[model samples]
Target: MATAEADVPTAALKVERGKKAPQFKGRDRWVFYAMVGIPTGLHVLLVWVPTVGSIFLSFTDWKGIRFSDITWVGLRNYNQIFTVFEKDFFQALINNTVLLVFLFLGPTLFGMFLAYSLDKSIKGTRLYQSVFYTPVVLSLAVVGFMWQSVIYSTENGLATQLFGGGEPVDWLGNQSFLISFGDTYGISKNFAAILIAIAWRHAGYIMVLYLAGLKSVDNSLKEAASIDGANEWQTFRLVTFPTLKPINVVVAVITVIEALRAFDIIFVLNTPRKTEVLSILTTNNLLGEGGGNVGRGSAYATILFLLCLGFVIWYVTNHYKSTEEGAES
Candidate 1:
């Protein structure tokens, strides 16, 4: 009877202690709250909320001037995108793709060349870096104005005095490069000029990426190849570039995203009505010609956003696939 009474008291004490144990520390509790709250709040506030709102907006005919005036329009906004201005829509898509390729592949290819060449010391390396990177610092407005003024027409412009002696050519209005060959092929001035401008601005940025990638590679491998009597080309193709796969992927993915989102350069070059990119088109509609079609504007924006997301995912996935193989090997 004494033992039984002691056991009952012990059980009671255990139960009381269980009820009174401290739950969490203040700092840890705060961190837990932050971890959950920050990401959840950001996703909801920045991405999900905006996306949901846009979907609803795309279905309405709201001018966005007043909250109470929005009206339901069903698939009309879509119809307008595909049917009313079909040419603009498709042409802009094609142009955007072209821009993506050049803005991405061009920078990748050229940056490798620049990085490889500059990987070693030469005369005035700093000067070359500055010269190449100057365009990057200039605002799109400055770039646009500079190009337009210089290439507007040879007659009044510097090119006119140099090439025509008097008559300035209307460079932007003419086809890209006039061919004198039997089979003449000329690029449109608008595309050509934009291409040059974008390339000039972004090539150096890619070079910086390539420089880092190049640095990450081990030089001992190159020395071993040279000792084996392998030529420079063979060494680079088999050794250095393979190691640079990750950097290339990173640069390409980033470049594609930037290209897809390009607006400022094109906008500064021409009026919204003239350049007519998806971004500008959305802007125009969001402001006016989209009628009171807030939904349509949102739809256009959604398309651009999706396109960028898709390309980024694709490029990054492929990039890492090769990287994983290299890592395993």
Candidate 2:
């Protein structure tokens, strides 16, 4: 009876403490509203308004000069994208896919391998890391320009001088194939050359991300695997790799985005023949450098946005569903 009576006061004290906690009143409530409302309003105005406007404009032919100029043509832009512009659209698609594959195979895997190698306390590990990471810190545009002038240039370039045999190779300008894959989608030798520079930078960036992921892994799991007579490769593949799933997802998304938006290096390289990606194609339309085609440009932009949005939505839905299932289990 006494214990039950004592528990009543403890419960009452907790309730009292809850009640005593500060609650926002009149003026404080206004401040809270202002804090949340202002940002929300700004985001709606700045981001959503433009996005909706762009989607509306995609169906219309507009010179982008005035609202009065927009004329709804109803699927004309999309029809051209499919029929008339099919070659350019398909070419950009194939090129972006090539970039995506190259980045995953070359940088993503290479970065993980590098991170695994450096996780061992090798001599001058920091120096090796710094060397690999330096390119990622440099501005891509500047790096692209440097690469163009120093390496790929036809006249007085390092590569030309080295392999010139007194006749400098036109590495960037040569449309002639070193090897053709088909009449259509074989690797362009010049495009492959540009990819070298891209991979160099991407490998370094991915290395840093993977290195951080590797650091967060528990040493005990590795030690346990070692005790089980597991070799280093077996241990990493079975035990460590699973733990790095989050980092893998992040790297995958980054690589995809990078591949899709590859521009600066290709751009600075004067968008050398057959090196076009979606971003460059989209920008060229928006700027009307290939003659004013606002409707077409907006269609491309909408396509890119929808593709990204779809991927994000799918990933988020799957991720959250799995999380909920795991929690329930």
Candidate 3:
């Protein structure tokens, strides 16, 4: 019996060594190439081609009409942006910064609070979640219209009835600066109203993201924290929050991107005066009436692109540095 068992082991080893790896040939090889190549081709064609083209076009003067009309201007468009359109540029920059700050302060924190509260498995949790999350699924354009027509309407709007105190408030049309800065740029009342609408939708999105992160947290950690006499806030700050580092990063990136690229809702609301963002400016220059100015528009686009790219680069660099330090430790 011992001899037989030893022979069986040798036979299995020989069989394993003799077995050949499978190889793809002809049809299988073509299928594998297709699986990889198709998506790569599409991504390059759709994303990189346009991006490179836009950067190239930024240095030239073009009316976006014909290739023959394209003129090599070499930084003239950028010069005009900083020199001629300085006011508009700075105003848009200020608005973008304000939106970024507001999103971080208002919706992000509120959403995290909502998510933490909802995670406790209270009664009617689903209904509460649905109520908060409903706005996230709605298009920004629709949300804009709803706010404009139903909520912020100057005449019989809900805001007028509730806060106006028998007086109608012109929420969307008010261009008066709420916080003025040196007679040049300020946060407009209209923009403030728009921010509320944006928050209504954005808070829901943040809530959903946080809720997902909360769900994945191990219950054992919470119980352990509780056993150690940690209060709710202490447990969250020390134990729960550390586990949600990935989600926090995602939320931060999304908030910054959303603030930077805010266009659709403002556009839907007819882009009130004193509320122009970089994206709105890009659209106006690129596709506005009177034969679009391709060069200047492309310049605007490149600047916006660079801002986004810079942030992403910074975040990635910081993340990797921290990761490496952690690994070394």
Pick by lDDT: which candidate is best?
Answer: 3
TM-score, each model?
A: 0.76, 0.84, 0.86
Cα displacement (angstroms), candidate 1, residue 190, comes to 1.8
The CA lDDT of each predicted structure is 0.72, 0.80, 0.89
Error of 1 at 34 (Å): 4.5
| 1 or 3, greater by TM-score | 3
Candidate 1: the clashing residue pairs are: 57-295, 58-295, 154-160, 154-168, 154-169, 155-168, 176-187
Considering summed lDDT, which 10 consecutive residues are worst modelled in model 2? 18-27
Model 2 stretches with alpha carbons more than 4 Å out: 1-23, 162-166, 177-181, 315-329
Residue range 1-329, candidate 2, lDDT tens digits:
46555556555566546445333444555787888889999999999897777678789988778879889999888899889987678667777888889999997789889999998878998999999999999777878788888987877888888887767777776655555557765556677778888888999899999899999999999999999999999999999999998888888788888887788887877755677777777778866366477787888877777767866776688779989899778
Q: In model 2, state the lDDT of residue 46.
A: 100
* Best-performing candidate as measured by TM-score: 3
lDDT, model 2, position 254: 86
| Cα error, candidate 3, residue 242 (Å) | 0.9
lDDT of 3 by residue, 218-258 (tens): 99999999999999999999999999998999899999999
Superposed model 3: Cα runs more than 4 Å off: 1-23, 314-329
Writing each residue's lDDT as its tens digit, candidate 1 over 169-260 gives: 76555544332212332234566566777787788888888877888889999999999999999999999999988787787677877777
